[model samples]
Target: METSPSLAGPFALGTFSSGAGPAFPGLVAGGRVLDLSAHAPTTRALLERWDDVLPLLREAAAAPAGEWRPVAELRVHAPVEPRQIFQSGANYRTHVIDLAVAHEPAGGRPAEQVRAEVAAMMDRRAAEDQPYVFIGLPSSVTGPYDDVVIPSWCTKPDWELELAAVIGRPAFRINPDKALEHVAAYTIANDVTAREVVFRRDMPEIGTDWLRAKNAPTFTPLGPYLVPAAFLDPGELRVTLKLNGEVMQDESTKDMIFGVARLVSYVSQTVELLPGDLVLTGSPAGNGLHHGRLLRDGDVMEGTITGLGTQRNRCRDER
Candidate 1:
């Protein structure tokens, strides 16, 4: 039987992804350091005509040359710079649990108090049956290994590991069932937060606002690459987080209470989504601030997916 053309992975030609040793020379098989932003026009044309590029991506991943550059030498950029960056929060039960746990100690409240708050929110939401969601600005996104600025003013910055979808085409009022069709690919995102800034800027009477807390400058670090969804089984693939070389968050996409396609459909039903736009599906349970541990200077944060590859970032204090 002839192999299907879409049975392949995302492609970038460079000496990257090869572990240790000299990078494969010449244009390596994988563009570990792709220049997507450099050729925006060409990329838009390609996405519009993905069928033509599928075969090309297959050819590239199959063969690679030696003499690749150390990861530091490569120029990396955000995988997808859509018109907007949309995000949802607390879509997972694990995250909600962690939030309650994290806040209990700090809020100086008993565990029951935290549970009571969550229970009340859940009960009210159940009565109204509203799916909570919010927006994240595009300006917050930075490339893999990029610095997540620790603004001096913000005290409670945090990180959330999310599976984001890169839209393949313009989708407005699209049905949930057909949402997958509009997904161009999947990428990893670290939704950085400035907890203090968020509350101060957004909240009314000490209540938090989503924009200031979630959309701090250089708060979202993304990339490595937008892995074509076709290459991923969707059902499998472990999502893991490591801090300072120790595993902190380890979960799977399977844990997502609301899956990717459902999110795409839910948002598109109300908002007009454009090609290259991203939907940051909610994060898994384990997060530093969620556990009462905040990020400090000289810490390394790394995120890796089973098949999608890894994004390693070294944190530095913002000047």
Candidate 2:
């Protein structure tokens, strides 16, 4: 499940391709990987200094796998044993409009209002490189094989392809310039949602405050592998999403509202980050489940992030 927390540790990963089979690639978990979400208390205690953990990950990667499960057979739990799960919203301008258009009642000035409102929402995101963050519970975590529930109220469930990071060590009041040192590695995140709850009458009047919509069980899908941060360039990576063999989201990391370092620094100031915590950076435009296009039983969702590899999960009923 790509559970290594320290950005400088060793780890194993699984990759999938359109023309390829299972790619069981391996790497040192922390030092090489740019993500730092896999921090554990024991690991944090071991490395008093941030840079010390990286070499340890390399050494551990070389160690024998006592009872390692193959990527095909194993179920992917959340990438981090996170102390807290943080997410960003309206990070992309087009995405804000795309979501707003999904909610308007067919066609009218209200629909146009929805579009303009979404445009305004996106403007807030572009105004600052710092991401708009939210929190999800550790209890909500699920593996890749688990079924994502289609809530009774939600006729429309959506998919958001996101780049998530795992923290490797303890960080508090850390400098933004030195933020890269605290990461563990990167992994693919599918931030599933129920659009009805996000913008519904029964729920709170607020539209963008998406706590329940984004916090459902199996709502966050992660893993396949935790690729070394050093293995791939984050700026050059592309994130792709497909539903039932149809292309939905095709965007790159370069479009992010906030890069990795700024996000870590911002979060560290408020909360003391622990190993194994997760941070979902945000998703690009072209979300289906949100646009009144919910997934039916037997549909499939697959995601491929640059160096981190691919994760393909089938959709099923909660029953």
Candidate 3:
């Protein structure tokens, strides 16, 4: 089906409203939102019937700008309420190498050699090993511009800006070659982490404790908009994050050792991926850990991914 000529370029999909009232699916264009509730009540509803709903959105976007609402007057939501969220860890080559070098500085070898060895290991993993995937609670998700509450009991809250892929269709054990076919769209996600809680010091044999380290209320700041996968070249996009207006994490998806298609297929090997499920490709290098700057109360984080839009979230201390 031919897309509406009016919706020519990369338009954003989201839910918005003038106040605290019910949110409606919207097509964002030129700082204005064209309500799509008449077509689909929620972004999840639109993704469920993505093929049919897309054409209608295009037509609606082509309509005259009479009913469009100024975005500044509206409240934006998390875009979609995902049923399941699959997150990738240690996916970016440089990010992992940095962590490795930081954790275990070379004893005799030059740092360059250590970096090279780690990179080689990543290459081997990409070729033979599976991607490390973790399940995240959907309850952790919040709107893009929402405030992040740093728990008082927690220290070393960190930021991991990642690219999230929203699944459009159901797939079970899909091959890597066809995995991207099921991706409906992409969004920006800040995978906030509690550094101190990542590992259980008392129970060394238990490995990672992602539940306490990652899943806190409003921990994942998702979406200023959802840019359809058809409109994005994930490999070409740059992911960047700024703390209090200073650049922290800034890198291109090109640096990822395992690409989106591979991550999706790798996870689908053990789990069924359904529509509205989010697959968060790992964060790029320059996380707070690398810079020696963890999140503090009252800090503001602004994250931007090329063509996907920007997200600004303030950090507040939990009461």
Best by TM-score: 3
**Among all candidates shown, the one with the greatest lDDT:** 3
What C-alpha lDDT values do all the predictions have?
0.66, 0.63, 0.86
What order do candidates take by TM-score, descending? 3, 1, 2
Output the TM-score of candidate 3: 0.93
lDDT of 1 by residue, 202-315 (tens): 436766678778877778887666667787766566778888888888988776656677778878878887777888877777888666677787878888766656677766
List runs of model 3 lying over 4 Å from the truth: 1-10, 105-117
My TM-score estimates for the predictions, one after another, are: 0.79, 0.75, 0.93
In model 3, which residue pairs have backbone atoms overlapping below 3 Å?
A: none
**Alpha-carbon error at 191 in model 2, in Å?**
0.8
Ranked by lDDT, top first? 3, 1, 2
Predictions: Cα RMSD each? 6.5, 6.8, 4.0
CA shift of 286, model 1, Å: 1.3
Q: Supply the global lDDT for candidate 1.
A: 0.66
Model 1 misplaced stretches (Cα beyond 4 Å): 1-45, 59-73, 104-109, 112-130, 200-207
